[model samples]
Target: MTLAAPIDPLAGAPGAYRDDLVEVVRTRHVPIGAIRTDSFAFWTDHDRVHLAHDLPAERIDNDLAGLVAAELFAPGWLEGSELFERLMTGLVVSAADDPLSAWTLFYRNTMDRLAQLTSLRPGAATEPHHGALVEGSLAGYAPVYRHAAGLIEPGSVLELGSCFGFFSLFAADRFAMTASDLSANTVRLLGRVAPLLGRRIETVICDAARVPRPDTSYDTVVALHLLEHLPAEHGAAVVTEMQRLARRRVVVAVPFEDEPTAAYGHVRVFTARTLIEIAIASGWSWTVHEHHGGWLVLDRP
Candidate 1:
Protein backbone atom coordinates (compact mmCIF):
# COMPACT_ATOMS: atom_id res chain seq x y z
CA MET A 1 0.00 0.00 0.00
CA THR A 2 1.18 3.54 -0.76
CA LEU A 3 1.91 5.93 2.10
CA ALA A 4 0.14 9.27 2.08
CA ALA A 5 2.22 12.31 1.09
CA PRO A 6 3.46 14.62 3.83
CA ILE A 7 3.77 18.38 3.60
CA ASP A 8 6.84 19.50 1.70
CA PRO A 9 8.81 22.16 3.53
CA LEU A 10 10.77 22.81 0.36
CA ALA A 11 7.70 23.00 -1.81
CA GLY A 12 8.42 26.49 -3.12
CA ALA A 13 12.21 26.31 -2.97
CA PRO A 14 14.07 27.37 -6.09
CA GLY A 15 14.45 24.87 -8.88
CA ALA A 16 18.20 24.83 -8.27
CA TYR A 17 17.66 23.50 -4.76
CA ARG A 18 15.68 20.52 -6.01
CA ASP A 19 18.20 19.95 -8.76
CA ASP A 20 21.04 19.90 -6.25
CA LEU A 21 19.27 17.34 -4.07
CA VAL A 22 18.55 15.15 -7.08
CA GLU A 23 22.17 15.33 -8.18
CA VAL A 24 23.33 14.25 -4.75
CA VAL A 25 21.06 11.24 -4.74
CA ARG A 26 22.02 10.33 -8.31
CA THR A 27 25.75 10.36 -7.55
CA ARG A 28 25.62 8.50 -4.24
CA HIS A 29 27.78 5.38 -4.23
CA VAL A 30 26.85 3.71 -0.98
CA PRO A 31 23.85 1.40 -0.61
CA ILE A 32 21.34 2.04 2.18
CA GLY A 33 21.38 -1.57 3.35
CA ALA A 34 25.17 -1.51 3.74
CA ILE A 35 25.02 1.50 6.08
CA ARG A 36 22.07 0.37 8.19
CA THR A 37 23.33 -1.40 11.30
CA ASP A 38 22.12 -2.54 14.73
CA SER A 39 24.41 -0.15 16.60
CA PHE A 40 24.69 2.98 14.46
CA ALA A 41 21.65 4.43 12.71
CA PHE A 42 21.11 7.71 10.95
CA TRP A 43 19.63 10.36 13.22
CA THR A 44 16.81 10.91 10.73
CA ASP A 45 16.05 7.17 10.78
CA HIS A 46 16.22 6.78 14.57
CA ASP A 47 12.46 6.70 15.16
CA ARG A 48 12.12 3.62 12.98
CA VAL A 49 14.49 1.80 15.30
CA HIS A 50 14.04 1.25 19.02
CA LEU A 51 17.05 1.02 21.32
CA ALA A 52 19.33 -0.26 18.57
CA HIS A 53 16.66 -2.53 17.19
CA ASP A 54 14.23 -2.09 14.34
CA LEU A 55 10.70 -1.44 15.47
CA PRO A 56 8.06 -3.96 14.37
CA ALA A 57 7.07 -3.70 10.71
CA GLU A 58 3.80 -2.00 11.51
CA ARG A 59 5.57 0.48 13.76
CA ILE A 60 8.16 1.24 11.10
CA ASP A 61 5.43 2.05 8.60
CA ASN A 62 3.98 4.48 11.10
CA ASP A 63 7.42 5.89 11.86
CA LEU A 64 8.22 6.34 8.16
CA ALA A 65 5.14 8.51 7.80
CA GLY A 66 6.37 10.54 10.75
CA LEU A 67 9.81 10.87 9.16
CA VAL A 68 8.19 12.09 5.96
CA ALA A 69 6.14 14.62 7.86
CA ALA A 70 9.29 15.88 9.56
CA GLU A 71 10.89 16.55 6.16
CA LEU A 72 13.61 14.00 6.84
CA PHE A 73 12.22 12.04 3.95
CA ALA A 74 10.95 13.69 0.79
CA PRO A 75 7.21 13.90 0.18
CA GLY A 76 5.72 11.26 -2.12
CA TRP A 77 8.93 9.21 -1.77
CA LEU A 78 7.16 6.63 0.42
CA GLU A 79 4.74 5.21 -2.15
CA GLY A 80 6.52 1.88 -2.15
CA SER A 81 9.31 -0.08 -0.46
CA GLU A 82 11.73 0.83 -3.26
CA LEU A 83 11.11 4.55 -2.80
CA PHE A 84 11.62 4.11 0.94
CA GLU A 85 14.97 2.48 0.20
CA ARG A 86 15.80 5.43 -2.05
CA LEU A 87 14.96 7.81 0.77
CA MET A 88 17.26 6.07 3.21
CA THR A 89 19.97 5.75 0.60
CA GLY A 90 19.83 9.47 -0.12
CA LEU A 91 20.13 10.30 3.59
CA VAL A 92 23.07 7.97 4.19
CA VAL A 93 24.93 9.22 1.13
CA SER A 94 24.20 12.86 1.86
CA ALA A 95 25.59 12.52 5.38
CA ALA A 96 28.76 10.68 4.30
CA ASP A 97 29.61 12.77 1.26
CA ASP A 98 33.15 14.14 1.77
CA PRO A 99 32.46 17.54 0.14
CA LEU A 100 29.46 17.91 2.47
CA SER A 101 27.44 19.77 -0.18
CA ALA A 102 24.55 17.38 0.37
CA TRP A 103 24.58 18.12 4.09
CA THR A 104 24.72 21.82 3.27
CA LEU A 105 21.58 21.46 1.17
CA PHE A 106 19.78 19.89 4.12
CA TYR A 107 20.98 22.72 6.36
CA ARG A 108 19.73 25.33 3.92
CA ASN A 109 16.31 23.67 3.83
CA THR A 110 16.06 23.73 7.62
CA MET A 111 17.09 27.36 7.77
CA ASP A 112 14.43 28.28 5.22
CA ARG A 113 11.82 26.37 7.21
CA LEU A 114 12.90 28.16 10.37
CA ALA A 115 12.59 31.53 8.65
CA GLN A 116 9.07 30.69 7.50
CA LEU A 117 8.09 29.44 10.95
CA THR A 118 9.32 32.60 12.66
CA SER A 119 7.53 34.92 10.26
CA LEU A 120 4.13 33.65 11.34
CA ARG A 121 1.72 35.91 13.25
CA PRO A 122 1.12 35.33 16.91
CA GLY A 123 -1.42 32.52 17.44
CA ALA A 124 -1.09 31.63 13.80
CA ALA A 125 -1.53 28.01 12.94
CA THR A 126 1.72 26.20 12.26
CA GLU A 127 1.94 23.10 10.14
CA PRO A 128 2.77 20.32 12.60
CA HIS A 129 5.27 18.80 10.18
CA HIS A 130 7.24 22.03 9.78
CA GLY A 131 7.24 22.49 13.54
CA ALA A 132 8.62 19.00 13.98
CA LEU A 133 11.43 19.58 11.48
CA VAL A 134 12.43 22.86 13.08
CA GLU A 135 12.27 21.37 16.56
CA GLY A 136 14.27 18.31 15.58
CA SER A 137 16.94 20.50 13.97
CA LEU A 138 17.46 23.06 16.73
CA ALA A 139 15.63 22.28 19.97
CA GLY A 140 18.26 19.99 21.50
CA TYR A 141 21.17 22.29 20.66
CA ALA A 142 19.66 25.70 21.49
CA PRO A 143 19.60 25.31 25.29
CA VAL A 144 23.06 23.81 25.30
CA TYR A 145 24.27 26.76 23.24
CA ARG A 146 22.82 29.21 25.75
CA HIS A 147 24.24 27.30 28.71
CA ALA A 148 27.71 27.11 27.20
CA ALA A 149 27.53 30.77 26.21
CA GLY A 150 26.80 31.77 29.81
CA LEU A 151 29.86 29.88 31.03
CA ILE A 152 32.33 31.13 28.40
CA GLU A 153 34.74 33.78 29.61
CA PRO A 154 35.21 37.09 27.86
CA GLY A 155 37.85 37.26 25.12
CA SER A 156 38.87 34.87 22.36
CA VAL A 157 37.45 31.33 22.30
CA LEU A 158 38.45 28.08 20.65
CA GLU A 159 35.93 25.25 20.32
CA LEU A 160 37.29 21.80 19.65
CA GLY A 161 35.32 19.04 17.99
CA SER A 162 32.96 21.63 16.56
CA CYS A 163 30.90 19.54 14.21
CA PHE A 164 28.97 21.92 11.91
CA GLY A 165 30.22 24.73 14.23
CA PHE A 166 26.65 25.71 15.17
CA PHE A 167 27.61 26.69 18.72
CA SER A 168 30.50 28.72 17.43
CA LEU A 169 28.10 30.55 15.12
CA PHE A 170 25.61 31.03 17.98
CA ALA A 171 28.29 32.65 20.15
CA ALA A 172 30.16 34.48 17.39
CA ASP A 173 28.64 37.88 18.13
CA ARG A 174 29.84 37.65 21.73
CA PHE A 175 33.24 36.06 21.19
CA ALA A 176 36.12 35.80 18.76
CA MET A 177 35.19 32.30 17.72
CA THR A 178 37.51 29.69 16.29
CA ALA A 179 35.93 26.29 15.62
CA SER A 180 38.12 23.23 15.05
CA ASP A 181 37.05 19.75 14.08
CA LEU A 182 38.73 16.59 12.89
CA SER A 183 36.64 16.41 9.72
CA ALA A 184 37.87 18.46 6.81
CA ASN A 185 34.41 18.41 5.27
CA THR A 186 32.74 19.97 8.31
CA VAL A 187 35.45 22.58 8.70
CA ARG A 188 35.23 23.45 5.04
CA LEU A 189 31.45 23.72 5.20
CA LEU A 190 31.64 25.98 8.25
CA GLY A 191 34.25 28.19 6.64
CA ARG A 192 32.07 28.61 3.58
CA VAL A 193 28.76 29.07 5.35
CA ALA A 194 29.74 31.33 8.25
CA PRO A 195 30.16 34.42 6.11
CA LEU A 196 26.90 33.68 4.32
CA LEU A 197 25.16 33.62 7.71
CA GLY A 198 26.68 37.01 8.68
CA ARG A 199 29.02 35.42 11.23
CA ARG A 200 32.77 35.67 11.36
CA ILE A 201 34.27 32.49 12.77
CA GLU A 202 37.54 30.81 11.93
CA THR A 203 37.56 27.11 11.10
CA VAL A 204 40.38 24.63 11.67
CA ILE A 205 40.65 21.02 10.63
CA CYS A 206 42.54 19.22 13.38
CA ASP A 207 42.20 16.57 16.04
CA ALA A 208 41.00 17.89 19.40
CA ALA A 209 43.66 15.89 21.30
CA ARG A 210 46.49 17.51 19.33
CA VAL A 211 45.62 21.01 18.16
CA PRO A 212 48.54 22.76 16.50
CA ARG A 213 48.09 26.02 18.36
CA PRO A 214 50.54 27.07 21.07
CA ASP A 215 49.81 27.22 24.77
CA THR A 216 47.46 29.95 26.05
CA SER A 217 46.30 30.66 22.55
CA TYR A 218 42.83 31.75 23.62
CA ASP A 219 41.06 33.05 26.72
CA THR A 220 38.47 30.28 26.67
CA VAL A 221 38.42 26.75 25.26
CA VAL A 222 35.27 24.71 24.83
CA ALA A 223 34.46 21.08 24.03
CA LEU A 224 30.72 20.80 24.19
CA HIS A 225 29.02 17.48 23.56
CA LEU A 226 32.35 16.14 22.35
CA LEU A 227 33.82 13.86 25.02
CA GLU A 228 31.14 11.23 24.69
CA HIS A 229 32.33 10.60 21.14
CA LEU A 230 35.87 9.77 22.26
CA PRO A 231 37.43 6.98 24.27
CA ALA A 232 38.08 7.68 27.97
CA GLU A 233 41.81 8.14 27.52
CA HIS A 234 41.39 10.29 24.43
CA GLY A 235 38.82 12.42 26.19
CA ALA A 236 41.28 12.97 29.03
CA ALA A 237 43.96 13.91 26.53
CA VAL A 238 41.56 16.42 24.97
CA VAL A 239 40.88 17.92 28.41
CA THR A 240 44.61 18.33 28.92
CA GLU A 241 44.88 19.85 25.48
CA MET A 242 42.09 22.31 26.23
CA GLN A 243 43.99 23.43 29.33
CA ARG A 244 47.16 23.95 27.34
CA LEU A 245 45.29 26.05 24.79
CA ALA A 246 43.39 28.30 27.18
CA ARG A 247 44.81 30.94 29.47
CA ARG A 248 41.59 31.62 31.41
CA ARG A 249 39.15 28.68 31.43
CA VAL A 250 38.18 25.37 29.88
CA VAL A 251 34.53 24.32 29.39
CA VAL A 252 33.27 20.80 28.65
CA ALA A 253 29.78 19.37 28.22
CA VAL A 254 28.42 15.88 27.69
CA PRO A 255 24.98 14.36 27.65
CA PHE A 256 23.87 12.46 30.77
CA GLU A 257 22.83 9.38 28.84
CA ASP A 258 22.61 5.85 30.27
CA GLU A 259 24.01 4.61 26.99
CA PRO A 260 25.58 6.46 24.09
CA THR A 261 23.26 7.57 21.28
CA ALA A 262 25.02 5.93 18.38
CA ALA A 263 22.84 7.71 15.81
CA TYR A 264 24.83 10.83 16.72
CA GLY A 265 28.03 8.77 16.72
CA HIS A 266 28.35 8.90 20.49
CA VAL A 267 30.68 6.12 21.68
CA ARG A 268 30.45 6.43 25.44
CA VAL A 269 28.09 7.61 28.15
CA PHE A 270 28.91 10.30 30.72
CA THR A 271 27.36 11.25 34.02
CA ALA A 272 28.01 13.88 36.68
CA ARG A 273 30.41 11.49 38.42
CA THR A 274 32.44 10.94 35.28
CA LEU A 275 32.67 14.69 34.66
CA ILE A 276 33.75 15.26 38.27
CA GLU A 277 36.40 12.57 37.88
CA ILE A 278 37.69 14.32 34.78
CA ALA A 279 37.87 17.59 36.64
CA ILE A 280 39.68 15.98 39.57
CA ALA A 281 42.16 14.29 37.27
CA SER A 282 42.88 17.64 35.63
CA GLY A 283 43.65 19.06 39.10
CA TRP A 284 42.32 22.45 38.07
CA SER A 285 40.02 24.72 40.08
CA TRP A 286 36.78 23.27 38.76
CA THR A 287 33.01 23.27 39.05
CA VAL A 288 30.76 20.45 37.87
CA HIS A 289 27.08 20.94 37.25
CA GLU A 290 24.14 19.73 35.20
CA HIS A 291 22.18 21.85 32.81
CA HIS A 292 20.65 20.08 29.83
CA GLY A 293 23.63 17.80 30.36
CA GLY A 294 26.73 17.42 32.55
CA TRP A 295 29.20 20.29 32.38
CA LEU A 296 32.70 20.64 33.81
CA VAL A 297 34.06 24.16 34.07
CA LEU A 298 37.77 24.52 34.90
CA ASP A 299 39.16 27.90 35.88
CA ARG A 300 42.81 28.53 35.20
CA PRO A 301 45.10 30.50 37.47
Candidate 2:
Protein backbone atom coordinates (compact mmCIF):
# COMPACT_ATOMS: atom_id res chain seq x y z
CA MET A 1 0.00 0.00 0.00
CA THR A 2 1.08 3.57 -0.64
CA LEU A 3 2.10 5.76 2.27
CA ALA A 4 0.58 9.21 2.64
CA ALA A 5 3.82 10.53 1.21
CA PRO A 6 5.93 8.97 -1.51
CA ILE A 7 8.78 6.83 -0.19
CA ASP A 8 12.05 8.49 -1.10
CA PRO A 9 15.46 6.82 -1.07
CA LEU A 10 16.11 8.02 2.48
CA ALA A 11 12.77 6.51 3.38
CA GLY A 12 13.56 2.91 2.28
CA ALA A 13 12.91 2.16 -1.39
CA PRO A 14 9.83 0.14 -2.41
CA GLY A 15 12.03 -2.85 -3.14
CA ALA A 16 13.85 -2.44 0.19
CA TYR A 17 10.48 -2.67 1.91
CA ARG A 18 9.74 -6.07 0.35
CA ASP A 19 13.27 -7.38 0.83
CA ASP A 20 13.32 -6.26 4.46
CA LEU A 21 10.07 -8.06 5.21
CA VAL A 22 11.36 -11.16 3.46
CA GLU A 23 14.56 -10.90 5.47
CA VAL A 24 12.47 -10.79 8.62
CA VAL A 25 10.82 -14.05 7.60
CA ARG A 26 14.17 -15.59 6.84
CA THR A 27 15.82 -14.41 10.06
CA ARG A 28 12.98 -15.64 12.24
CA HIS A 29 12.67 -18.86 10.24
CA VAL A 30 8.96 -18.19 10.02
CA PRO A 31 6.85 -19.44 7.16
CA ILE A 32 6.67 -17.05 4.22
CA GLY A 33 2.87 -17.54 4.28
CA ALA A 34 2.69 -15.58 7.53
CA ILE A 35 3.60 -12.37 5.70
CA ARG A 36 0.72 -10.07 4.78
CA THR A 37 0.78 -6.77 2.98
CA ASP A 38 -1.29 -3.63 2.80
CA SER A 39 0.20 -0.38 4.09
CA PHE A 40 3.15 -2.58 5.17
CA ALA A 41 4.12 -6.23 5.08
CA PHE A 42 3.59 -7.84 8.49
CA TRP A 43 3.34 -11.29 9.98
CA THR A 44 -0.14 -12.55 10.63
CA ASP A 45 -2.23 -15.65 11.00
CA HIS A 46 -5.65 -16.23 9.42
CA ASP A 47 -7.19 -14.80 12.57
CA ARG A 48 -4.97 -11.73 13.13
CA VAL A 49 -1.47 -10.31 12.88
CA HIS A 50 1.10 -11.71 15.27
CA LEU A 51 4.52 -10.62 16.51
CA ALA A 52 6.61 -13.36 14.92
CA HIS A 53 10.02 -12.41 16.27
CA ASP A 54 12.18 -12.40 19.40
CA LEU A 55 12.00 -8.63 19.90
CA PRO A 56 10.43 -7.44 23.13
CA ALA A 57 6.66 -7.10 22.74
CA GLU A 58 6.46 -4.25 25.26
CA ARG A 59 8.99 -2.19 23.28
CA ILE A 60 7.06 -2.70 20.05
CA ASP A 61 3.79 -1.84 21.82
CA ASN A 62 5.27 1.41 23.14
CA ASP A 63 6.36 2.45 19.67
CA LEU A 64 2.96 1.63 18.20
CA ALA A 65 1.22 3.45 21.07
CA GLY A 66 3.11 6.63 20.18
CA LEU A 67 1.74 6.42 16.64
CA VAL A 68 -1.76 5.67 17.90
CA ALA A 69 -1.59 8.47 20.47
CA ALA A 70 -0.98 10.92 17.66
CA GLU A 71 -4.42 10.04 16.33
CA LEU A 72 -5.98 10.96 19.67
CA PHE A 73 -4.57 14.53 19.64
CA ALA A 74 -6.63 15.10 16.53
CA PRO A 75 -9.57 12.77 16.10
CA GLY A 76 -12.04 12.26 13.21
CA TRP A 77 -9.69 10.67 10.69
CA LEU A 78 -10.68 7.14 11.65
CA GLU A 79 -13.39 5.93 13.97
CA GLY A 80 -12.76 3.60 16.92
CA SER A 81 -12.75 0.34 14.96
CA GLU A 82 -10.52 1.72 12.22
CA LEU A 83 -8.09 3.15 14.72
CA PHE A 84 -7.79 -0.22 16.44
CA GLU A 85 -7.01 -1.90 13.16
CA ARG A 86 -4.37 0.73 12.40
CA LEU A 87 -2.78 0.20 15.80
CA MET A 88 -2.67 -3.59 15.30
CA THR A 89 -1.17 -3.18 11.87
CA GLY A 90 1.55 -0.92 13.25
CA LEU A 91 2.34 -3.35 16.07
CA VAL A 92 2.80 -6.34 13.82
CA VAL A 93 4.89 -4.44 11.32
CA SER A 94 7.06 -2.94 14.04
CA ALA A 95 7.44 -6.33 15.69
CA ALA A 96 8.74 -7.98 12.54
CA ASP A 97 12.07 -9.78 12.77
CA ASP A 98 14.11 -6.93 11.32
CA PRO A 99 14.73 -4.01 13.71
CA LEU A 100 16.59 -1.89 11.18
CA SER A 101 13.46 -1.86 9.01
CA ALA A 102 11.39 -0.74 12.00
CA TRP A 103 13.80 2.10 12.72
CA THR A 104 13.84 3.16 9.07
CA LEU A 105 10.05 3.25 8.95
CA PHE A 106 9.95 5.30 12.13
CA TYR A 107 12.48 7.78 10.78
CA ARG A 108 10.55 8.19 7.51
CA ASN A 109 7.18 8.63 9.20
CA THR A 110 8.52 11.05 11.81
CA MET A 111 10.21 13.16 9.17
CA ASP A 112 7.03 13.19 7.11
CA ARG A 113 4.93 14.23 10.10
CA LEU A 114 7.36 16.99 11.08
CA ALA A 115 7.58 18.20 7.51
CA GLN A 116 3.81 18.55 7.35
CA LEU A 117 3.78 20.30 10.72
CA THR A 118 6.50 22.82 9.85
CA SER A 119 5.18 23.57 6.37
CA LEU A 120 2.16 25.26 7.91
CA ARG A 121 1.99 29.05 7.79
CA PRO A 122 2.62 30.72 11.10
CA GLY A 123 -0.62 31.46 13.01
CA ALA A 124 -2.62 30.27 10.03
CA ALA A 125 -5.74 28.20 10.38
CA THR A 126 -5.56 24.67 9.02
CA GLU A 127 -7.35 21.35 9.21
CA PRO A 128 -7.24 19.53 12.56
CA HIS A 129 -5.27 16.64 11.11
CA HIS A 130 -2.67 18.77 9.40
CA GLY A 131 -0.09 18.68 12.22
CA ALA A 132 -1.87 16.51 14.74
CA LEU A 133 0.28 13.49 14.06
CA VAL A 134 3.54 15.20 15.01
CA GLU A 135 2.03 17.23 17.82
CA GLY A 136 0.73 14.10 19.54
CA SER A 137 4.07 12.33 19.15
CA LEU A 138 5.91 15.30 20.63
CA ALA A 139 3.53 15.81 23.55
CA GLY A 140 5.35 13.53 25.98
CA TYR A 141 8.95 14.32 25.06
CA ALA A 142 9.00 18.00 24.05
CA PRO A 143 8.99 19.12 27.66
CA VAL A 144 11.94 16.87 28.35
CA TYR A 145 13.80 18.49 25.49
CA ARG A 146 12.89 21.94 26.73
CA HIS A 147 14.07 21.13 30.24
CA ALA A 148 17.32 19.68 28.96
CA ALA A 149 17.86 22.70 26.75
CA GLY A 150 17.39 24.96 29.75
CA LEU A 151 20.12 23.14 31.68
CA ILE A 152 22.62 23.23 28.85
CA GLU A 153 25.84 25.10 29.69
CA PRO A 154 27.71 27.42 27.39
CA GLY A 155 29.83 26.08 24.50
CA SER A 156 29.59 22.79 22.65
CA VAL A 157 27.25 19.92 23.59
CA LEU A 158 27.24 16.20 22.98
CA GLU A 159 24.17 13.98 23.31
CA LEU A 160 24.86 10.29 23.72
CA GLY A 161 22.38 7.74 22.52
CA SER A 162 20.76 10.51 20.51
CA CYS A 163 18.42 8.10 18.69
CA PHE A 164 16.71 10.20 16.02
CA GLY A 165 18.55 13.37 17.23
CA PHE A 166 15.35 15.43 17.59
CA PHE A 167 16.60 17.10 20.77
CA SER A 168 19.87 18.01 19.07
CA LEU A 169 17.89 19.55 16.22
CA PHE A 170 15.70 21.45 18.67
CA ALA A 171 18.66 23.09 20.45
CA ALA A 172 20.87 23.59 17.42
CA ASP A 173 20.18 27.34 17.33
CA ARG A 174 21.50 28.01 20.84
CA PHE A 175 24.46 25.66 20.99
CA ALA A 176 26.99 23.82 18.84
CA MET A 177 25.60 20.32 18.91
CA THR A 178 26.87 16.82 18.25
CA ALA A 179 24.59 13.80 18.23
CA SER A 180 25.90 10.28 18.81
CA ASP A 181 24.24 6.89 18.71
CA LEU A 182 25.29 3.26 18.77
CA SER A 183 23.53 2.61 15.47
CA ALA A 184 25.51 3.83 12.46
CA ASN A 185 22.32 3.83 10.37
CA THR A 186 20.66 6.25 12.80
CA VAL A 187 23.69 8.54 12.78
CA ARG A 188 23.83 8.47 8.97
CA LEU A 189 20.15 9.33 8.69
CA LEU A 190 20.51 12.17 11.19
CA GLY A 191 23.55 13.43 9.29
CA ARG A 192 21.52 13.54 6.09
CA VAL A 193 18.44 15.15 7.63
CA ALA A 194 20.24 17.77 9.72
CA PRO A 195 21.41 19.70 6.67
CA LEU A 196 18.00 19.30 5.01
CA LEU A 197 16.44 20.96 8.08
CA GLY A 198 18.97 23.81 7.87
CA ARG A 199 20.79 22.82 11.02
CA ARG A 200 24.51 22.14 11.54
CA ILE A 201 24.77 19.10 13.78
CA GLU A 202 27.79 16.79 13.95
CA THR A 203 26.67 13.18 14.01
CA VAL A 204 28.86 10.40 15.42
CA ILE A 205 28.52 6.65 15.74
CA CYS A 206 29.75 5.63 19.20
CA ASP A 207 28.70 3.66 22.21
CA ALA A 208 27.59 5.83 25.09
CA ALA A 209 29.63 3.90 27.66
CA ARG A 210 32.93 4.15 25.83
CA VAL A 211 32.70 7.31 23.73
CA PRO A 212 36.08 8.00 22.17
CA ARG A 213 36.51 11.50 23.54
CA PRO A 214 39.03 13.08 25.85
CA ASP A 215 38.19 14.16 29.37
CA THR A 216 36.07 17.31 29.46
CA SER A 217 35.63 17.14 25.71
CA TYR A 218 32.34 18.99 25.72
CA ASP A 219 30.90 21.74 27.89
CA THR A 220 27.72 19.79 28.46
CA VAL A 221 26.89 16.09 28.09
CA VAL A 222 23.27 15.09 27.94
CA ALA A 223 21.62 11.67 27.84
CA LEU A 224 17.88 12.11 27.73
CA HIS A 225 15.66 9.06 27.77
CA LEU A 226 18.66 6.75 27.30
CA LEU A 227 19.35 5.22 30.70
CA GLU A 228 16.23 3.10 31.02
CA HIS A 229 17.24 1.01 28.06
CA LEU A 230 20.47 -0.08 29.79
CA PRO A 231 21.19 -2.39 32.68
CA ALA A 232 22.05 -0.94 36.11
CA GLU A 233 25.78 -1.56 35.78
CA HIS A 234 25.91 -0.30 32.24
CA GLY A 235 23.87 2.78 33.16
CA ALA A 236 26.39 3.65 35.85
CA ALA A 237 29.20 3.21 33.39
CA VAL A 238 27.48 5.62 31.03
CA VAL A 239 27.10 8.11 33.84
CA THR A 240 30.82 7.89 34.48
CA GLU A 241 31.49 8.36 30.79
CA MET A 242 29.26 11.39 30.71
CA GLN A 243 31.08 12.88 33.65
CA ARG A 244 34.43 12.12 32.07
CA LEU A 245 33.39 13.83 28.86
CA ALA A 246 31.78 16.95 30.34
CA ARG A 247 33.50 20.08 31.62
CA ARG A 248 30.40 21.86 32.93
CA ARG A 249 27.62 19.43 33.76
CA VAL A 250 26.13 16.01 32.99
CA VAL A 251 22.36 15.70 32.56
CA VAL A 252 20.41 12.45 32.59
CA ALA A 253 16.69 11.91 32.18
CA VAL A 254 14.46 8.85 32.47
CA PRO A 255 10.74 8.31 32.44
CA PHE A 256 9.20 7.64 35.84
CA GLU A 257 7.27 4.48 35.14
CA ASP A 258 6.16 2.00 37.81
CA GLU A 259 7.87 -0.62 35.72
CA PRO A 260 10.00 -0.33 32.58
CA THR A 261 8.10 0.18 29.36
CA ALA A 262 9.14 -2.77 27.23
CA ALA A 263 7.87 -1.21 24.04
CA TYR A 264 10.46 1.52 24.43
CA GLY A 265 13.18 -1.06 25.18
CA HIS A 266 13.37 0.21 28.74
CA VAL A 267 14.85 -2.37 31.07
CA ARG A 268 14.40 -0.50 34.35
CA VAL A 269 12.58 2.37 36.02
CA PHE A 270 13.92 5.48 37.75
CA THR A 271 12.38 7.65 40.44
CA ALA A 272 13.39 10.85 42.18
CA ARG A 273 15.09 8.80 44.87
CA THR A 274 16.83 6.65 42.31
CA LEU A 275 18.11 9.70 40.51
CA ILE A 276 19.36 11.10 43.81
CA GLU A 277 21.22 7.85 44.38
CA ILE A 278 22.80 8.14 40.97
CA ALA A 279 23.85 11.71 41.75
CA ILE A 280 25.43 10.73 45.05
CA ALA A 281 27.23 7.85 43.44
CA SER A 282 28.81 10.26 40.98
CA GLY A 283 30.50 12.20 43.83
CA TRP A 284 29.54 15.55 42.37
CA SER A 285 27.33 18.46 43.40
CA TRP A 286 23.96 17.60 41.93
CA THR A 287 20.24 18.27 41.72
CA VAL A 288 17.50 15.71 41.25
CA HIS A 289 13.98 16.65 40.21
CA GLU A 290 11.00 15.78 38.09
CA HIS A 291 8.81 17.48 35.54
CA HIS A 292 7.82 15.41 32.53
CA GLY A 293 10.17 12.81 33.99
CA GLY A 294 12.90 12.29 36.56
CA TRP A 295 16.09 14.25 35.99
CA LEU A 296 19.58 14.07 37.50
CA VAL A 297 21.90 16.98 36.94
CA LEU A 298 25.55 16.83 38.02
CA ASP A 299 27.73 19.91 38.19
CA ARG A 300 31.45 19.62 37.58
CA PRO A 301 33.96 21.21 39.91
The most accurate candidate by TM-score is 2
lDDT of 1 by residue, 164-255 (tens): 67778778889999999987755876787677767799988999999999999999999988998899899989999999999999999888
lDDT of 2 by residue, 139-221 (tens): 44545676788898779999999977877877788999999998775588778767766778998899999998899999999
Lowest-sum lDDT 10-residue window in model 2: 17-26
Worst 10 residues of 1 by lDDT: 14-23
Q: Give the top-scoring candidate (lDDT).
A: 2
CA lDDT of each candidate? 0.62, 0.64
Show where candidate 2 strays beyond 4 Å.
Answer: 1-11, 19-65, 68-136
Q: Residue 126 lDDT in model 1? A: 60
Output the lDDT of residue 101, model 2: 53
Distance (Å) between predicted and true CA of 77, model 1? 17
Give the TM-score (vs. native) of candidate 2: 0.66
